[model samples]
Target: MNNLDLQKLLDEMTLEEKIDQLLQLAPAFFEGANSAGQITGPLEGLDLAVENVRRTGSVLGVGGAEEAIHIQEAYLRHNRLNIPLLMMADVVHGYRTIFPVPLAMGSSWDVELVRQAAAIAAKEAAVAGIHVTFSPMADLTRDPRWGRVMESTGEDPWLNGQFARAFVRGYQGEGIANEPYKIAACIKHFAAYGAAEGGRDYNTVDMSEWMRREFYMPSYRAALEEGCEMVMTSFNTVDGIPATGNRRLMRELLRKEWGFDGVLISDWGAVKEMIAHGVAEDEKECALKAIEAGVDIEMMSSCYPHHLQELIASGAVDVQLVNEAVMRILQLKHKLGLFENPHRYADSVAEREILLNEQHLAAAHEAALKSSVLLKNERNVLPLAKDAKVALIGPFATSDDLLGPWSCMGKREEAVTLAAGMLGVADPNTVTAIGCGVEHIPDEELAAMVEAANSAEVVVLALGEDSEMSGEAGCRANIQLPDRQLELVKRVRALGKPLVAVLFNGRPLDLHGVLDEADAVLEAWYPGTRGGAAIAELLYGEANPSGRLTMSFPHSVGQVSVYYNAFNTGRPKDDPNAQVRYVSQYLDIPNEPMLPFGYGLSYSSFRYGEAALSSPLIRAEEKLLLTVTVTNVGERAGSETVQLYVRDIAGETVRPMRELKAFRKIMLEAGETKEIEFEINEPMLRYHHADLSYKSDPGKFEAMVGPNSKEVQALSFELV
Candidate 1:
């Protein structure tokens, strides 16, 4: 149906029908009994309420190909208007063939891999009859402490935008409106949810309009430009107004100013939670505020279905606003071809054929390998000889704990463990011992593992947070390895063997112990099902690790808000005496992060040469060419991520000390030299001024090129 047809349908619907269109019912798979034995509302069974809602108009959240077809049949049989139900699922990473989380994928700096991951996710999700996926969360999160940061691409807006476009193209392949199996991509958390106060999930976001426009809004815009069909509103309040009810953000800016024609869905229960935000007195008021703010769908929030009509009748919201929202929802269904053929995606044959296909597994393996960053390889202790008697220590050594959280579809039993993969590459006599669990293990077990390590030629200790330690509702009180696990590492190190620490985590860990003790450290951040295979490849010199740190690793949780791009304080903590005054520096630890963003090591070494600009001065319409030489100094072939960072130097408002402008991941043979160049246009140099205009100031600028934030070669340029 065209927009005119959707608008005509909306015009003819009753208030009840319009309200029904706005509500999204939960899937039967999510409604069931809790561990407490009490019936915990629909997280897993087909409820009578779901059937009633389907009978009224249309429903959402029907799962699997067969069940989706059944729901479509019911909607056709029972709905008075014969409107088709839309099925939505949270296909965050992969549907069944799991890939590394978004943050890990971002470290690869490979757009094609990112696209392929989303494409596989869409294929599996579509096979299950899902017409829409709420994914490609484009939030620019700098703080690793935020549990949801793992869900985002990374800290830089440009990189996030690149991945956002790739994901949108991948999910809505060849346009969602035309493809039978393609699902609509819902670019999420509309604005600045990543800047939540203190990195706490769902906390209020307080940022200047300048910051919001320059850094936060770019990813959303990129997703829209890439043809995303829907957007999910964030749960947190921005400038004291809940996103679900913020008319200035949702209506005035997003819709009117940016011309976003796609549907806007609220995050789960966000509309009802407006009462908790102290913005709405009741669900009725919440419905009114959200509808007026231009939210098209209320996900898992009963407020719209129960109270929208009452609010509309009271003149608290206009009928036109209701019609507009309903029209957008119907348009999305039309785009999904739901109105014409409701059962188009409900193919049982495709469902069984697509999930965990060989191609998907291969892609997952490639992603896992690319995301595994070789953080430290002191004296080249890694690439352990295939014939060496290696001792695989730590609980995760044999456990499938590398598969991180929000992995609803991944089977731990199917994942390859480090010990299994290592044994595949090493001699049959290779020793394996469980040194310590990520969380709990007896002291005697640790001692026995350490003794085995002493008998081996080399020891590989796999350490990291448990699978449940990061993701939604998995916030940590401390961002370090569990003290017991660290103690186990200390004991293993005392064995006097060549030690390699493989970290399996969802976020950057405080690796002070690994840095000081381990001979080699590989940051395998929750490498998916093929995690073990990837680790083995990196270990045996089959693949060179090239992934970089997308987020900073803080020295301590006390330095919680640390990032490469931070506003300089009037009293900078540059001097030891200034640190004594207790300005921004912690007394016990320095303000710097343990590992800066864009920091990663390889099996081989790299040296960054001096940076040069093509032109020292340029006009608004012109561009600057930045060139730098990167040489592979080590004896082995490897890849290096050459990063380009820029400082505003002077602006109308204070700016971050440095911002990532461009990055290129280059593969070089031993002793090879590569000249990496970046074209810096207005967008690269632009920042939000006090007036909220994204403009580049005509002043002196500093362009730096290097391996990471701290190590760089700088050159000054004048923008005239």
Candidate 2:
């Protein structure tokens, strides 16, 4: 529909109808609506009436195309305006062909691969009749204690921005209005939801504006600038006001400043939760504040439908506010071409043919293979010979819990198991045993596991958190592996057998015992449907492990928020010779994480030459080309991600000790060397000032190039 037609439709809508259009309901409501105008079938918990349910604008979490078609048909028959229901779901990583979690995908450091995985997800979701996906969560997180960290890419602003744009491009390819098998992408949790206090979910976030701009807001801006069609408000407060009702955050900053005219949605019931946040008095106040703050749609909340009409009548809310919000919703429906074809992209036959097809499975396999990081390889114990006898012990050995949380439409029973993958690759003599559950081990199970370990040439200990232990509400106070699994490790160690540990988890954990006890360690984080097959190939030397750590692995949960980009203190601990007690240092533990960002290992070793610069000085808009030679010194062919880090020596305010500016992932044959180059300019050194000005200071700058954040060679340059 054109602008005139949409405006006419909006003008024709009654005040009650306009208010109802801002509400989103589940499929149950539509299935329950009757000709007598009474809603049935277990929807008594909601405050919505039959008339409002029929004219509801959107549906949340519809299962498949068949259900979506049924809902749309039922909805249109009752809908006076004939506006089809907008279908949406949380398609975070993948739809049917589950790929690695976003955190693991960030470890791959391959943006093109991220784009491909999202495109595959979009195709599958579109066939399932989903019109919008709440995905590519752009929250920059530093604490692994937060279970939702699995949804974020990593802790870095620049890298998160890169992944954010890639997701938007993949989901709404070209544009959703012009494409068929694509869905509108909704970049979520608008403000800093990741910086929840104490790493607890939905906790308070208190950060200065400068800090917010410098670290947390870049990725959201990148997604919106990439033409994302929707934004979901976070459940946390911004500057003491809940983001759902904070006019400064939603209306002023997001709409006027950023020019995001797309739909702005409240995260499931966030608008109503404002009352729980102690800011609003009741449902009427909730409706007034959220509408004034520019929330175009309310998800799974009845505050708008319950009190919006009364608020407008009492002059608490202008009717024009409702009109504008309704217009945005109508424009989105028009953009999706829903008016012309109510059943857009809903085909049961196409859903079967396209969901989890061979090509998608292949892509998922590649994502899993690259996203699995080799954290430790003490000796050449990896690349196990196919003829060697192997014993796979622990709960994950035969379990198919590879699909992490929010795995939309993925079935765990259909996933490949580690035992099956190992049996397919290794010799017939390989044996498997379930030594313990995630947290408990029986005496008989322990004895059986030890017997199998003694008979094998090597033992592969599959251990990590359960799928239930991470994602949304999966926060934990202690992130260490279960004590029983650690005990299992000690028992296997007593057997004097070569041990390899394979971890399947969502967030980074304190790998104290496992890291030290195992001869080799692979951080295979929730590798999706084909994860077992991918791990099997990497174990048997069929493929090389190339992924790196995006978030730092803390040495202990006590050091919860440890990350690479930290500020330097006045009294430093840099000088090893200085024995001063006044320095900022920990008495019992080291300041560094056990494994830093960009830290990963390959079977083939890489050596970096000294970094060379074209010039020592650069001005604004001038480019300084820095080059380094990376050679595959070891005997195997592999891939390596060369990272470029920059440090601003002095600035308007203090800057991080080091910030990741850029990186390049390249494949190398044995004994082959390639020159890697990166351009440095003034823009790379800019940061938000105390007064909220974004610019760089003219001073000395240091550049470092290496495989990871910690181990690198540095060079100094001047920026004027």
Q: Each candidate's TM vs. the true structure?
A: 0.94, 0.98
Report the C-alpha lDDT of model 2 over 508-616, residue by residue, as the tens digit.
9999999999999999999999999899999889999999999999988888789999999887788666667878878888889999999999999999998898999
What does candidate 1's lDDT look like per residue over 253-285, in tens digits? Answer: 999998998889888778888998999998888
Q: Which candidate is the best by lDDT?
A: 2
Q: Each prediction's Cα RMSD? A: 3.0, 2.6
**Candidate 1: clashing pairs of residues:** 29-44, 30-43, 30-44, 31-42, 31-43, 31-44, 31-45, 32-44, 394-435
lDDT to native, each model: 0.81, 0.90
Error of 1 at 372 (Å): 1.0
Q: Model 1's lDDT to the true fold?
A: 0.81
Q: Count backbone overlaps in model 2.
A: 0
Per-model tally of clashing residue pairs? 9, 0
Model 1 per-residue lDDT at 92: 79
Model 2 regions lying over 4 Å from their true place: 32-45, 433-436, 575-579
Best-performing candidate as measured by TM-score: 2
